[model samples]
Target: MSRQQLAKLDQLSTGQTLKFNYRQNGVPREGFLVRLKDTWVAYENRCRHIAISLDSDNGEFFTQDGKYLFCQTHGAVYEPDTGLCVHGPCKGANLFSIPLEIGESGVWIDME
Candidate 1:
């Protein structure tokens, strides 16, 4: 795995999201880091159904009620626990996983 330092965990806050790019197979791919329940979860931003970004124009990718991550492109609802597309067109689909670990310093993107 290629090494890409996204950001420090303390730099993020609950309900916030940040975008980062990593080189995979020599191609730069974008992903997202979301702060949820005082922890960070990372996943490829592309939706499984149409390969479109889940976030809207402003990078806001959550439901109005802030319960789940909603894909604006096709209205897919993903469960944060597993990055599984639990509702909408891509039901049973799952987002690409990016392993992450947390510590006293911050969260780190596991590139292993």
Candidate 2:
């Protein structure tokens, strides 16, 4: 797998999300890095309901309790573990996942 150096894990805080580009299926795709439970997870940022960005003003993408990722645009809630929308408009919709792996070097996006 080809890995790309995107951003430092320390640069992100719990409940924060950042967008970046990575190669998938031999094509560049946009994805998001979300900090949760002291771990970072990467997923496609597009909301399945309307195919829009999940983050709203100031990149605020989490719920008030910071338990789940919430889409302010359409009120869709997603599970941080699998990027699956558990409630709201797209009940069965799930965020496309990007390959991610953490190691001694740091978090990395697998572009294989």
Candidate 3:
């Protein structure tokens, strides 16, 4: 696997997300990294139900309570760490997780 840095650890506060853009075979894609409790989690930013972006252009991915990732378009809720859709239309599905590695310097994605 090849590693690419996404963001520095200090760049995100707990419960906040950092959106990242990447190219796959020259096609553009978006991903996001979030700090959850003691670990960081990454997802493809696409909603499981409609395959649309979970957040708007403003990067609003969390619900009002800030405990779950919210899809404003379809009202789907996901577990931040596990990416499991615990509520809404996509209850049985999960967000596509991106393999990530965290180091002292930054958060990195395994591009394979």
Candidate 4:
């Protein structure tokens, strides 16, 4: 399987996020990785309510309180660890989760 590095595990602190691009089946896709308090999470940037980015290019994924993921365009709130949309238009839906592999070198996502 092919993989791409997203961020250095040492560099990403708790509550920080990094955005990266990758290709799946030759189609470019956007993804974001967040270093949550106790673990790491990654997801496709697209909001379930609409095929738009969760953040309005501002790179802000968490709510001001840092308790949940916030979609600027759709107001969809997602539970960071589970990707479950607990509130807003996409309620009952989930964010597309990208399995992440955290290693000493960095955070990686399988590209295959």
Give the per-residue lDDT of model 2 (tens digit) for 1-112: 6778656767777777787887777876678888777677888777888977787535677788888887889899999978889999998777887767777676787676
Question: What is the clash count for each candidate, in the order shown?
Answer: 0, 0, 0, 0
What does the lDDT come to for candidate 1?
0.79
Better of 2 and 4 by lDDT: 4
Best by lDDT: 4
Off by over 4 Å in 2: 56-58
TM-score for each candidate, following the candidate numbering: 0.86, 0.82, 0.91, 0.94
Which regions of candidate 3 fall more than 4 Å away from where they truly are?
A: 24-26
Cα lDDT for residue 38, candidate 1 = 54
Give the per-residue lDDT digits (tens) of candidate 3, residues 15-68. 988899865555678998898879999998899999889996779899999999
CA lDDT, every model vs. true structure: 0.79, 0.79, 0.87, 0.89
Query: How far is 86's C-alpha from truth in model 2 (Å)?
Result: 1.4
Question: How many pairs of residues collide in model 4?
Answer: 0
Model 1 lDDT per residue over 1-112, tens place: 5455676767877888888776556667778888887578888888898987788546887788888887987799998767898899999989887777676667667453
Which pairs of residues collide in model 4? none
Per-residue error for 28 in candidate 3, Å, reads 2.6
Candidate 4 stretches greater than 4 Å from native: none
The residue ranges of model 1 lying beyond 4 angstroms of the native Cα positions read 110-112
Q: lDDT score, residue 36, model 2? A: 77
